[model samples]
Target: MALPDRYTGDDFYCDVAIPSAAQLDVVHDDELVLAYHHTRPFWATHLVVVPKRHIDSFTSVTECDEADVRQLFAVVQRLAREVTEREGAAAVLTNLGRYQDSKHLHVHVHSGPQRDHT
Candidate 1:
């Protein structure tokens, strides 16, 4: 899939990626959440799980985001389990503050050997 000339991660999930999820290798999709293979994978098996709605970041979650938060973690757990079962090991992770490249909340479910960085 062709990407923008500049791969800026800032809010890419909500602004760009989610809208084009159908074209991606989607793992899971529903009204509340979407999970798909990463466009630029860091591991042999790398998947991204995110809320369908716009939530700035985990730290920025508000009371109104309760349902979305629950759904997000539930999806992450399921995807992590699937990856672990298939690869014998898996990691579930989310970034924050400076670590978070994207402004939107997202979790990564990944396993297997690490790939070379681009």
Candidate 2:
């Protein structure tokens, strides 16, 4: 039989750091939280926001998880504002299936210089 949609696996959670690997100041955190920017980023400013909980994916969100979801979005909005203030603009995104790398549910917040088509 196929594995259940919400199977708790080893790759569920992760430790997110800012500057990709370089130790920097922590902007925000909670009991289970990791938020930071990428050292080598696609955008001028790229940050990864994830819950300490090992959630499978967005599709796995349950009715009981409504509060968690709300909290996640709230954080995202707050972070977006911060990024906009710092970078002048921001974008939020999440991946699914093959696009997902950590296996844990996460949202990517990006902002910075706009790419120029040469």
Candidate 3:
């Protein structure tokens, strides 16, 4: 199902713009709007990227937001490249519906050791 035109505004739950002090240095001040690293990373590196604006979800995104989405992905790609150079691989992802926690649209970038094949 699709979301409503007007965001519920409750989507803005996070106030800790940047998760850590080190993150401040790692992420570009101007480029970074908000971020958070996974406590238990599925990969070696897992970080969340969010725009300052409160966007509901990917499906809620409109044609007017194309540039914003492009810019957001550019940042994600840059981070992925950095991780790849440091760890040999990176993965980007996003969730919807029940999978999402805050209801705000965000992307996740993960990198690290490969899972062993049983």
Best by TM-score: 1
Question: Clash number for model 2?
Answer: 0
lDDT of 2 at 115: 45
Model 1 residue 18 CA deviation in Å: 1.1
- Which parts of model 2 have CA positions greater than 4 angstroms off? 1-12, 15-25, 113-118
| Model 3 weakest lDDT span, ten residues long | 12-21
- The segments of candidate 1 whose C-alpha lies over 4 angstroms from its true place after superposition are 1-5
- Model 3 misplaced regions, further than 4 Å: 1-26, 31-42, 113-118
The candidate with the higher TM-score, 2 or 3, is 2
What TM-score does candidate 2 get on C-alpha atoms?
Answer: 0.69
Q: Tens-digit lDDT track for model 2 on 1-118?
A: 2223353443533443422223633445665556666434567777776665666778888887676677777788899999889778889999998887667777878986744435
Q: After best superposition, candidate 2 residue 72: deviation in angstroms?
A: 1.5
lDDT for model 2, on a 0 to 1 scale? Answer: 0.66
For residues 1-118, write the lDDT of model 3, one tens digit per residue.
2223333444532333333334332353344345556433566578777765667888799887776677777788888888789888788889899887668778888877644435
Q: Please, what is the TM-score per model? A: 0.91, 0.69, 0.67
Candidate 1 overall lDDT versus native: 0.88
